[model samples]
Structures are given as structure tokens and as C-alpha cells.
Target: MPRLEEITPDNVSAAVDIKVGPEQEAFVAPVVTSLAEAYASRRTAWPRLVYDDDRAVAFVMGNFDPDNETEAFRCGIWRLNVDRAEQGKGYGRFAVLAFCEEARRRGHRRVTVLWEQGEGGPEAFYLRLGFRPTGEVLFGETVGELLL
Candidate 1:
């Protein structure tokens, strides 16, 4: 089984390198760096690295917050990436589950994720994991939410 650990600046390089293929590599690098900076600025955000033994295989970054209007605490699954070489081994699912559990422990009542339409990407994967579309789109991405 893969283990999830908190991401630190020291391991960000390895995390960036784990992205699979040229297309993914281009998209992942800048986003990971931005997420890292966001996490650093927002200390309450959760950022994690998934590792198989000593090799870093994936990453997830998000945060928990209480919706003022709804008065419900919710978790956001902002960014998730599993190394190309490590894809299809169930590692991504396990990592997300672990993150959800952590969010629950932190008092979140639900978790949400957003995915853009088109191309090879996470929309189908998030759907497979039981996340329902909100029927709302933002910045060209579909928003999805799942009750914990």
C-alpha cells in the first residue's frame, strides 16, 4: 500500500518530476508550484505527498472551510496528481480516500472537486469515485461535490 505524507518544500522537486508524459508534465509543474505557494500562505490548507516506499508517487492539495451561507463545514479537493508510471495501480483512489478521511476528522461534512471539460483528465475519474456534478461551471471547469 502507498502511504500519504505531508508535503514539504524539500520534496516538491520529486513531486514535480513524478508527473507522467509531456502534456501532463507541462500542466503539472506550474500548478504544483502554485499550489505549494498557496499552501504555504494558507497554513490551514492540507497538502500531501503519496509515496511508495521512498519514491514519491503522487500529490494532493486542498482545504477545509465552513460555508457561511449554508453553515456547513466542507472540504475542497483542489489538486490531485498521480505519477504516470504509478497510474492504474489504485494509488490515486487510496490517496483521495485518505485525504477525505483526514478532512472528515477535521470536521468537514462534505468534499468537493472541480474538473475541466475536454481531453484526457480527471472528470471521469472523479465521477467514478462518486462525486456528483453541481451543474455549475466555473472558469470552464465542472464543479463536483460528495457528502462525506
Candidate 2:
């Protein structure tokens, strides 16, 4: 079974090593960048590693700033990267559902996600998980929301 692990000194290297395929490169930022962003926004960013046994297979960052100026930033997934080899084993879904459950625990009623449109972007994956476009586009990325 897969489980979420908080980023720590011991597993930081493994988290940074997670990478997606070349086709998905343009859609998601690197885990290192997300880590840096998490540092800058430490109060609001909830970043974690998806581990299957002892192997870190993905990185997911959730933003939980209920008072953020932007609606999409209120309570949502800011970045998700499933390692190239670990794409289809349901790790991505597990991470997202985990985030949604976290959001609910935080008293949030919805979870948002942003996705760029491209050949191998994550729009379809988000949709498949019951996230529908919120009909708002920010910086050319479609805003998606899943009600919790």
C-alpha cells in the first residue's frame, strides 16, 4: 500500500529525485522548485512525498491559505509530480485524495488545481478524479475545483 510521508531531512534527497516524463515536463515544475516554493511559503504549503514501501514515487504540494487574495490559492493542490516510472499505479490519485481529505480536515469545502493545456498535461487526470473546470483561467492555466 502507498502512504504519504512528510518531507524530512532523511528523505529530502529522495523527494527531490522524483521526476515525471519528458512529455509531462512542461506541465509540472520540478520537485526541487516546489520545495523552494514550500520554503518561501512555509506557513501555507503542505508538501509530501508519496511512498510505496520504502521508495518515494511522487511529490505533492497543497496550498492552504484560506485568506489568500486569489480564490484558487485558498485551498488547493499547487503541484503534483508522479515519477516517470510510477505514473499509473494509482499513486497520483492517492496523493490527490489525501490532499482532499486534508482539506476537509482543515474545514475546507473544496479543493482546487491548476493545469496547463498540452498533449500530455494533467487535465484529463484531474477531470477523471471529479474536478471540473471552475471556468476561470489564470496565467493561461485552467482552474479546476473538486468539491469536498
Candidate 3:
């Protein structure tokens, strides 16, 4: 199973090097962009590098704000990307499970995610991971939630 490690000074460069294929560039931002957003939302975001054994294979950024009552979708995954070479190997699914576990550990009853609607989008993948549409649209993306 793949595990998540915080992007630290020692491994930030490797995490930044993680990428998806050209076709997926339109669906998800590069790791650098995700890192920048992490910084911008530092108060709630937890940016991580996904590792399988000793190799870095993916990048994930999530928000955990149990106190965010104003926004139902506040505590959720913000970004997720598995390097093209690592796709279809269950890494993304492992990462989602890990994120949900983390949210539950932090006392959250559920986790949520927002994704764009397109061919390469992760709507189906998230659904397979037990997430369901919340019927809430924000900024052109659909919101999905998974009760923990």
C-alpha cells in the first residue's frame, strides 16, 4: 500500500517533480501549482507526497477544517494526482483512503472533494471511493462527500 508523507524541505523537490501526462494537464495543475495553493491555504491545507515503498509516486493536497461551519465543503481534498507512470496501480485509491482516515482522526464525520466535469476528471474515481455528489456546485466544479 502507498503511504503519504508531508512535503518537507528534504523531499519537496521530488514532490515537485511528480506529474501527470499531457492529456491530464488540463484536469489537474502541476505539483508546483498545488504547492503554491498549499501555501496560500496553509492554515488548513496539508500537502503530501504519496510514496510506495521508497519511491515517490503521487501528490495530494487536502483541507481539514472541522470548524468551518460556513462552508460545508471546506474540509475536503483540494488536489490529487498520480504520476502518469503510476496510474492504474491503486495509488490514487490508497491516497484517498489515507485522506479519509486523516479526516476521521481529526474528528470529522465526513470528507469531501470538488472536481471539474470533463473526460479526464476524477468524478468516477471519487465515486468508486465512496464519494457521492452533494448537489452543490461551486466555481464550476461539483462537490462530492464521503461519510467517515
Candidate 4:
């Protein structure tokens, strides 16, 4: 199973090397962008690089309300991406599970995700993971929630 690791100064460069397929470019932001936001956003964004053992395979960014209030949004996934060569190998699902576990550990009762509409988008994938649409939209993406 893949695991999430903190992006330290030593490994941050390697984390930025990870990339998703061109077709998925619209679905996720690059690691560099996510990391930059994480840095600028302070405690609100928790960014990590996903690894299959020692091999880096993906990047995931989780956003949360630092005060445990909905200042911006609840605890939820902000970004997820697997390298083009590593897609369809279940690393994405592994990252989701890790994110959910982390959310639960933080006392969140549920986690929400916003995804853009399109064929081959993550709506169905999130649904399969037990996320139900909340009939809400964020930044033009549908909001889906999973009870923790």
C-alpha cells in the first residue's frame, strides 16, 4: 500500500517531480502549486507526497479549518494526483483511505470533496468510496461528502 509522507526540505524537490497524465491535468493541480499554496496558506493546508515504499508515486493536499470552524471549509481533500505512469494501480485509492483516516483522527465526522463535472471525472470514483453529493458546489465543482 502507498503511504503519505511529509514534504521536507530534503525530499520536497522529489515531490515536485511527480505529475499526472496530460488528460488529468484539468482534474488536479501540480505538486508545486499545491505545495506553494500549502506554504502560503499556513495551517489550513496539509500537503504530503504519496509513496509506494521508497518510490514517490503521487501527491495529495488536504485542507482543513484550523480553528475547527468552517472559516473556509471543513476538513476535506484539496488535491490528489498520481503520476501518469502510476495511474490505475490503486495508489489514488490508497491516498483517499489515508486522508480519511487522518480526518477521522482529527475529530471530523465527515470529509467533503469538490470535483469538476466531466466524463471520466472523479464524481463516480468518489461515489464508489461512499461519498454522496451534497447538492452544493464550490468553485464550480460539485461537493461530495463522506461520513467519517
Clashes of 4: 0
When sorted by TM-score, best at the front, the candidate numbers are: 2, 3, 4, 1
Residue-level lDDT tens digits of model 3 in 46-111: 888899998999998888776787465467888898999999999999888888888888888878
- What candidate 1 gets wrong by more than 4 Å, as runs, is 25-31, 67-74
lDDT of 4: 0.84
Tens digits of per-residue lDDT for model 1, 30-78? 4467566665758546777899899898887776655434322247776
Model 2 poorest 10 in a row by lDDT: 16-25
Candidate 2 — which residues are off by over 4 angstroms?
none
Question: What TM-score against the true fold does each predicted structure earn?
Answer: 0.83, 0.99, 0.93, 0.92
lDDT string for model 2 (47-128, tens) is 9999999999999999999999999999999999999999899999999999999999989999999999888899999999
Q: Which residue pairs collide in model 3, if any?
A: none
| Model 1 worst lDDT window (10 residues) | 65-74
Question: Lowest-lDDT window of 10 residues in candidate 3?
Answer: 65-74
The digit string of per-residue lDDT tens for model 4 on 5-69 reads 99998889888999877777888888898988999997788888888888999888888785665
Which candidate model has the greater TM-score, 2 or 4?
A: 2
In terms of lDDT, the poorest run of 10 residues in model 4 is 65-74
Candidate closest to the true structure, highest lDDT? 2
How far out, in Å, is residue 109 in model 1? 1.7
Query: TM-score for model 2?
Result: 0.99
